[model samples]
Target: MSNEHFSLQAEIAELENILRTIPEEKAISRLSFESRLEEARSRLAELGEPVVKEKLQLTFRGQPVDGTSGILADFGGKAVEVFSSAVSTVMASINGDIGERGPVAKKDADKLMITGTAVGSFGFELEVAGNSNPLFEEDDVTAGGVVEIIQDLLETAATGTDDEITEVVDVIHPRALKKVSEFLGFLESQKASCGISFKGKSFKFSNNSQLSNAALKLKDQNVKERPVEFEGKFVGFLPHSRMFEFSIRETGEIIKGKIGSKKIDIEQLSDNFLKAPVGVTLNSVSVGEGKPKYTLTSASDIRAKAGGGSQPPLTQE
Candidate 1:
């Protein structure tokens, strides 16, 4: 295990070296580091991020959403992405406590040590937004914002006689609090109501007659045709095609993917190309196993701290 850990560390250092070779001037784009960082994090997680996550109490505008579950979705398998602003960066060195009577080589190997940790929290605000139906006739009240919706409903219930907005908050907030509970239950219900489907289906990996013919000659009666376009952030090699052209985003993310002059939504691509090596940039992640500690990486971006303290306070803003 120790050897494997060292090997992985060496691999990361090598990757860093490769990235450094890319000219600094060329890699100065604001999105470059983020994109690359996401990619690295994704790959590392796949190889084993060695990081951890903890279930967080969810809330929105001080109103307890009732239920919430957070997954290191990018790192683990769950997906309840919360905006984490409170990140604490730490660096420490531990001295060798076990003294040795032998030569200095043993001491040298165990001596000076430096390690850094990025800790932050990922929080979710439970607020729902909906667009007014175009077919419906316009009404004086709107159900767009959560607070507004609550206010509108309360006003109607009281016939505009009593104040329900503030009262509702004051009453429900303590009862539910900010921590959302029963997250997986909600997800299960959603799954039952709305089937989870990826958009990028029926993608052909190759167009060569040999490859295409092989696919056409599938023997698996239950096998379904895959529909996903394997693509890249910066460049994509046409495994088998005449020519390819597309505007590449400077951030190495993506503007749009054009296949034979047809635009495609990247989200659709992501869904279709699930399990394709993806990169992710995290503000922070928890450590330890189930009840882990969280460390922040993109502290500034996560919190938008303005030279004040560490990060922004956790509040639905």
Candidate 2:
């Protein structure tokens, strides 16, 4: 057996032993015990099973479906269960619940299926169903498709075209529309809070609060800019102004970086005066005026290279 399989077996054995030894007085929560046991069994099931790694594509009414597509590890060779779980997770994330949605049909060990109507906020109703080949050996599997349907629905509610949103609402059950609507509003609010806008999409902020605030102020205007993050070298530091210069490794773009007033010490970095490679998270870039002005929000993971040389002074276009 593989090391991963052996490790899973050992873990299962340990969990089983613990379950057996629990005192009756302390085992007040049978539900908790059962939950842990179920989790252990699921892991055990995953050990020897062939997993789905390719992106799952599902077509609805001739058009390709759009949703989150990626590997789903080991699905226990059960299509319906996998689909149900995937749908439930996506729905629950937006506070929408899936009520009474199964009886998952297992057509032999290779295929499992489910077909039903689902209700969401605002009395919206949609047909929730699809089939897939559970056996990894099979060339056909709609498990991803089934999951994609629900995912696409959520995505539509989150950030889809007006037509897409209307179509999704028509199918969503009334009970779930409120939650989905709220979720959509939440996404919109998040985008607005970012302050930088381009092509109807808002820029996302990095973890650094100081830099993020500076970026927000710099890009608050009605200019178009692309947000990007990359690693670069800290080639110069202006101690008086507390500004630094960075040469982006990938694009060779030299950026004049300034720390927030509250973050003046950022230019000091470390004593090492050599080439300092740092990760730069730019909030936005405006290229309409002269040279592109890159609004940097954060710099981290600074590492020193062997050699160092003086970089040319930054010039305005």
Candidate 3:
């Protein structure tokens, strides 16, 4: 087996051993047991295979909600099939799983459509238009695809301008508007401006704060620490932290601007200089003030924009 696979197995084994040692007495602290369980589960997650059955929940208007009719695997397969089949079949499947008295009427099926999909730690949730047909086939839908669609939708809802937000509020269902707005506000507070990505239906949101890189690298114990460097355009200054922000040209990932102990008056720099291209190197990063902070070891290759006039490089030795 590959080294990575072997290491993951070893970690899982260690966690399992630790879990076994934990006493099963009622006197055991609930927090202690929960902490151990969480660690074990996380290590097992590194195995990259579903280790436990995922619960599924389905909700339909005019029908009793079925919170746990089946496992995620079964539900995922059925969802794909429903998306691909005729509208009638989709209605029948949903009704059958929920123990509804009868198949939905033709009028209801016409209203059936996939409103939205969201992924959580436990599983995925799908919102449908009034008995709406998702109009997707088994071949076209995958768990990852569902996640991407949701992430894109959420990002749009979160980052859109005020005008856009108003339009979204007017268009989306009233029930979902509040949730979308709340999630958007949360993302803003967390500085999730680098956008949201996913791993196995779980979100990995990127932030524009200084300590993002370090936090991401250290967030998973299974991940090894390493030096990171990137080239990007000096975007702007965050006066609140007295740092200059850079936008990675290739990935669009924002580099939380830092100057370390270097004595440079960023406010004195011209707007063009602030917008020049820069190279940044980071190591031994940490989080502070609710954001990632890192050593500003050096900033090099400062290139000014064409026609913006010549200016001194903003490199730090």
Candidate 4:
């Protein structure tokens, strides 16, 4: 899938230029200023519109993001500015020093809020639902929590006792006990979750937290909770949905393993990733015996085709 990361400000600038030449008046003497204004308004109209469709996909950490396609939103509000500044001062950390990420790509990527150095949970949720702001602080909180935990762990390893190491591990990542943990599930719990068993014959909803007892039940006698984890940054995203910052770290699955076996030995274990909006994610893990294979069996149906005879940027009032 293709990513939609574009240069937003630049795009807006271009749109403004195009709209300015629209010739609103039949015989205007010299409406250079008016033309410019009209251009901005036209571009703003385009930008302000929600994404007609979006195709979301999840890619594991260390791996290239599959699709960069997504919606864009404006965070240039008074509240955002005030809090952003205050946050910079109060946090006093390198992470919080975000003014704006200028010109990520020449194609006009957006300037959303995030810790300066971290890839926060959000990935510009395209206005697929009409122009809506990305849940900035709420989502960032979870991302920040994970970062804090990992940061603590790294610190512990640097200059702490063995006891401290264990302590930090328990608090932050009790599951992955290594000196480092790759990635936790995005979202502390999960906004949306679907569990499928028997190769997708049946599915379970995380919201209801109940499964059809008769639908391919797990044999409790053989079932064992060894440990579960995702590949580096490889959190599950429903089809076409936005990637989340946290997931149910407390419970995941240890597929195809006994009580003592807690490692996927497949040379290329692949698992399906759902980001919801409509798109499938493909990930590959280590290779070995008993390594589980993953495949994003489905995709979403929401996406606006690229390469519509795009004129220069323009804004709407």
Ordered list by lDDT, greatest first: 2, 3, 4, 1
Candidate 1 deviates by what RMSD? Answer: 29.9
Give a tens-digit lDDT track for model 3, residues 117-187. 33322223432321112333322322333334434444433344433333322222222232333433332
Q: Each prediction's TM-score against the native? A: 0.13, 0.24, 0.23, 0.21
The root-mean-square deviation over C-alpha atoms between each candidate and the true structure, in angstroms, is: 29.9, 19.6, 21.7, 22.4
Question: Could you give candidate 1's per-residue lDDT for residues 1-317 as a string of tens digits?
Answer: 23554565666676676666676666465346546655655665555423121222222111122223332333221223211100000000011111123221111111111121111222332222123323212321111222232223222222321223222222221112111112222332233110111121111112123222222222122112222222222133232331222222234433222221112233333333222332222211111111211111211212221332332223211
For model 4, give the 10-residue run with minimal summed lDDT: 258-267
Question: After best superposition, candidate 4 residue 1: deviation in angstroms?
Answer: 20
The reply for model 1, stretches above 4 Å from the true place, is 1-120, 124-136, 140-143, 147-317
**Which parts of model 4 are misplaced by more than 4 Å?**
1-139, 142-148, 170-173, 176-317
- Candidate order by TM-score, decreasing, is 2, 3, 4, 1
Which residue pairs show backbone clashes in model 3?
83-136, 112-131, 112-132, 112-133, 113-132, 113-133, 210-292, 211-292, 211-293
Total clashing residue pairs per candidate? Answer: 19, 19, 9, 70
Which window of ten consecutive residues has the lowest lDDT sum in model 1? 85-94
lDDT of 3: 0.39
